[model samples]
Target: MSRGARFTERLDLLWLGATVGVGLLGLRLIHMQVVRNQHYSELAERQRTQVIAQAAPRGRVYDRNGDIVATNQPAFSLIFLPGKAQDPARLAGLADSLARELHRDRGELFERLLEAAREETAIHLAENLPLKTMFKLSELKTLYPGVDLIVEARRHYPYGAFAGHLLGYMGKIDRRQWQRLKGKGYRVDSWVGRSGVESRYEDVLRGVDGEIRMEVDAQGRLRRRLDEVPWQVGGNVLLTIDSRIQRAVEEGLRASPSGTGAAVALDPRTGEVLALASTPDFDPNLLLLPEWDSEKQAVASLPEFNRAVQGTYAPGSTFKIIMDAALLQESVVRLDERVFCPGFFQVGNRAFKCWEKKGHKWVDFLASLAHSCDTYYYSMGLRMKGPTIERYEKLFGLGRKTGLDLPGERSGNVFGPEARKARKRGWYDGDTANLSIGQGELLATPIQMALVAATVANKGTLWKPRFVKRLERPGRPPEDILSEPVGRVDLRPEVWDKVQEAMVGVVKGGTGQRVNIPGLVVGGKTGTSQNNLGDDHAWFIAWAARPGEVPSLALAVLIQHGGHGSSAAGPVARKAIEAAFDLASAKGHEAPAEGAM
Candidate 1:
């Protein structure tokens, strides 16, 4: 009887304990499902959800006439989600598969995948893919869980190689740049401007990027998008370049015998750059190709070189214009004064020969400039010496930067008394004679020479070169860029008149006669810069205008190794003038014949 009672009590205690445990478990379930539901739900959601950034379209580039130069095009890119490939085996397999399709090294791809996995972020595997490769990648997506395809905006240039140096190109951001720009909303895969106007205006062109918050399944496949912030497109840049004039300038350069040089055209009244062209230009679109590395050395040779602001050469006899002005201003030489030139001038027993072997027997100020008599200037240079010539050169803005908006503008060399003194070198009359005639250590950019013509045309005003006409932005007013005056040349009215008349005489029948256009009064100076490495560099600086009105156009043309200024550089300048005034296509309008400088 005692044993049966003990067993019944034990059973009763076990039943009571089981009932208490069941009640406690029910309370715990209620707590998790109600009181702290939001907190625990968020924890689980964070494990399966991710935020992916979408690239923003860069700003567009336009010429002065509203022609689009640079814009955006839709491109297919391979996106890798690192969270799905965190496992070592899965990551290695995915990297190997992507490397084959992308033509990338497997070890490099594996390392990149491993780094992204450690950062718990997504990355771009391959971009700007061809449609055929994109389709192959899409098929690979079925086999690879973390792989995806997305459309992105790729930078495109419409004119191909035209104005390529000025328009610039783009490239993917390296790790160093990403570290600096990531706070500014730039992604690791973001493309940035590498040169030209594109690099100069990167801040204005690079708009803010946006992202999409999405939910993913256990396998890392996107299930549904929770929310998204739309990306903002960048501002629009309008250049001061006239596409027609730019085309003419480029055509002239390409047509030259060297096929390697630079040209610049400017509005004489304002410093607006009508056309800025450099030869051996590149098609920026080609750089976006996957095989670009193979052609990199060839591309760097000539195509990427921006010769307009970057190339500096001796001004040659064109510097005679400065000598003419300096001599007249100092009263060292009169407009009617005559000098004898028998082909050569004797300076310290050294003979400097003129371009014309049998030179002008005797020439006055105007005739000296008109005929580009090297002997006449050589004789006068000895009297002027170093100080006076240096003064005029500095006043004319030689050997200095033009402050053009483009990047990498070089300040050409100006070696005179000061420079020679610093280097403990001697200054001689021979040196002065050479400098006086735009030779020997006197170098200038095409832009500087163009400004010289503009200064003469404007009768003494110097305008800062302007490239951008305006900036157009969405949801904002258009910003117009205006011309800014940097300096002015002060001379007597008669001084300007004499200089202008002599220059006019140049086109009327002198070395630069080839630039002559009908019904347009043209003034120019011919130059044959001596290049030790090759043949002389031909140059012509000129300005054109209608009768009884201010000049409108100014130009500077250079032909590397193109022997004579009048014969080589003159024709190119003539072509530019013809295009500017629409005379090349005009009926019965014939350009003047090339003459000797």
Candidate 2:
């Protein structure tokens, strides 16, 4: 119990305390390395490894005859890996060099490089780089530690701006879309179809991405594709469109003074859209480029509006076709019964003037439709009022969606009793008169007009118009194919014959004479719808051959701000019809049965 004995005891206690501390530290290390190993490993993996998305090539789109309209081409992209870089200055220098080579501002490149050097992990330096530029960048890879060249697939339209609206375009994924599609495998760099068929068939056209697990060193260089899973290419789309006829329609539309217009041609038998053209089309390639001024100008120059499916115009005299059909169906107006036209007719407090201010003294239904006698139909529309006309309009696919596969399809404005009431406008006799001639409150898209034409051409049956013929998926079984059926609407035979004959006469002796193609029986109706909002919309709806033709083609043309249907739209329709006939002749297919005009 002396001082020496006390010192030795203290040393023993200190040694024991030290041993206990070391044992505790060893147990803690085991717990962290073993029990919590996965958590830390995951955190390390998250920090060191980044999953960069590789975009799958979108499917190619083809025409009816297997002509390629839309396809994918190889693109080079510049990517930056922040984790691979050591010095920020080196990264900045590399970015500056790239900026100089690509003709970009050095400050912008420096800012981007600084951002990329952060913990963001993956950053895109540039996208859709040309192959030559990408190869040059690859050669200079040693100068840029983190920068790398990536081969990507980009959407390409073979026909440039042709059928652009129908084909649509793709754009980079935005914040909203990214948030919505993040877990669903969509990445920020992913391109999505923003409009038209591209938007509508996005799911079908977006191919599945493949993945490869590669072993990399601390420097992050790939060793091999470990257990690689191949990606699936997008499906192929076969359109019902005839490129030849589509080109002709586009050329004719472009030739007109009104640069904005749309033309849709369909097969009466199958409701296949032969040609769908929209004027003022912007090239999809331009949208993908860096030239903003060129892009704006290109879009501005063309109407960029799809007039055929989206352009809504007053039917004008063309509504006579519907009225005539409804009258014949209801037996309200006899086909041979004569109605006197004194240039204008008085309905309620309004006196609606006919197209021919100098009236035809007396005219029957056939002559009325041929001459587009407004007074005759104005009287008839009064008899067939409200629900009666609405029924016919619905049957003709007006005021409703055509269910076309393309996106942004409008149901069009068809004012019913409720709609009229909502608008606070009472349905007056004058309204009926105007409606009879397709003027008052009646608006129809060019596609709707084409449908009406098809109904008349097919006698009584109305077929649902379709643009997409078939979808071909890669590596998938054919049994999984999706095919839309040909829809038909039934009508009385007599009603069909009388309407058909009148439509035929419209082309032969009436306003559509300009559209008559040689060696082909063309039945058509011309419409100059009044647009007080702007210049009148010119329209022409027609179909080739009689009811019996198996592949009967129907068409409708709309000219924006064009003065008259005959002058603006008729010539476009004529060119398209001529092209179709020429195609038939070239293929040795029998020309549509010739019917005298």
Candidate 3:
């Protein structure tokens, strides 16, 4: 072979090797781009595109008379799009400038931005921002890359602190709630009701959120909305509460010297709560703001607790009514039976003293209730026994949840045989004596007491107390709703008559005389429950007019640390009843049946 031939052959082999290498490289590229394209595309989409959720507006709450109590208002928020920002310094500068424009602390705003950035692909600068600031930020989006504006709905209460406890307040969605609601599409930015009616009706109040499909530009800005689905606003909640009566209860409670207490007024015929008031309430608007430390501290410091359904206190003389019911139920004591009282009764070695040291020589059931004679009830308690008393207590809805639509209701304490054993105590004669007068181990919430009053007013039927009357959606028909009834007891009409007479005497000539309203037939019981650990709790339970009047109103009032039911609690009831009647008259309704003490 010649030298020229050898060189040509070597060049041909080199060309063939280069062509084979190029063919292998092209095959590898095809495998990566086409065969694994979906996996890579998903990875890229995760980095560049994010799914954000929008919250739905909470439902509106209204009084029975169609007055708005709670609603939602439009709010603005500042958001960050990480895909558009190039540097942290620029992000910090934009946040600081925005904070200054909003009259907020720049440092705080910067800290929040950094914190949000750490967890979210795009951080929210501020939630519920003012509309003007949102518009300003939107216009200056060019100066602040990755920063955007979001509009939201915030809960608003127009009545201020009037029915704060009953209406409750919403708070930020916590970690546990976020996890629970994540599957349901709830975001961290969502707010939920934490107490009262708001918490109880959360499902109905939280409306369905909608969606928007939008096309964006390369700069991560929304060019236009392609398809939009409007969000469904929550239903309207109509409560049985009367705002006028509620305001009157608040005013009367505020006028009292006692700083804390609760009052609940109900309609005996339907078991509908007319007015529920808890003193030292906080403004619901405070919860709508972002920084709630100061407002939370203020609420914590005040006696803002909902005492009407939460506070448990001894019943004092009011237990006598329960005793009366038990005696009638058991046939242990007749309505006309007379018991002798000498101001004190001896139970074994212990001498139980009555309210009147020198009691009336002979007292019937009516007179006993009027004078709140401890001796008379003590004698009856000895005959009735613990089991019988407990039976009547349960029947009257004592020591149980009222099942009202509002949240945070407590089951008050009633000591049955099993309960007594659990508490490491044994039933005794003295315990029975104390129990007869509604003291010792017995405790009840204001709503519980109000139910008891209603039970007696209705002669024997017990209606489950209810707050919400109807639920209606915008542009939809209203749906009437009701709570499940517990059961009913049938007491003789004669027994109700006797009990009614005694209760009426309580206001006319007995300890509750101070609460007497002229021309108003007010049947009531006064209770001064002694508290060994603190000041006595004053209590008054009453039903306006007679049973024949269909019990237009039934009420229970409790004044924490208030001395006497006659002086402290009774006046509050009187004022509440008067206001309720006045409210009815103002609405062009006939004057409620009037009666004297």
lDDT per residue as tens, model 2, 1-597: 999999999999999999999999999999999989999897676445555567788888889899999898888888776554457677668767787667777888787777755664556777777666677778656665456777778889978988888888888888999899878778766789888778888877888875544443344444344555667788887888899998998898889868788888988767788888887777887777642334534554555467777778787777778888889889898877999999888886778887777786799989888777888887887777866887777777888878776766677778545568888867766666667777767788888888888777766566667788787777765322233434445668878888878988887777777765556777778888788888888878888863356337788888888867777887788888778776432222222312111
Question: On residues 1-597, what C-alpha lDDT tens digit does candidate 3 reach at each position?
Answer: 999999999999999999999999998899889987898896565445544456788889999998999998888777665543345686578667877676677887777666644543555566776566567777657886556776777788998887888888888889999999878767766788888778778777888776654444434455555666677778778899999889878877777668678999999888999999988678878766655245644565555468898889888888788888777767898777998999799999999988777776799888888878888888999998878887788888887888886667789899655569887888888888888888887899999999888888888878888888998876678889875567786787877877777888877877777656665688899898788878788889999863346678899998888877777787678778887776232222222211111
The local lDDT score (0 to 100) that residue 199 gets in candidate 3 is 79
Q: Return the TM-score for each candidate structure.
A: 0.89, 0.86, 0.84
Per-candidate total of colliding backbone pairs: 0, 2, 3
Q: Between 2 and 3, whose lDDT is larger?
A: 3
> Which segments of model 3 are wrong by more than 4 Å?
1-54, 83-85, 95-123, 130-143, 148-151, 211-227, 292-297, 300-304, 334-337, 358-361, 416-418, 421-424, 473-477, 546-548, 583-597
Whole-model lDDT values for every prediction? 0.84, 0.75, 0.78
TM-score of 2: 0.86
| Candidate that would win on lDDT | 1
lDDT of 1 at 167: 85
Give the residue spans of candidate 2 off by over 4 A: 1-9, 28-53, 83-85, 99-122, 131-142, 211-230, 291-304, 416-418, 422-424, 479-490, 546-551, 583-597
- Candidate 2 lDDT (Cα, whole model)? 0.75
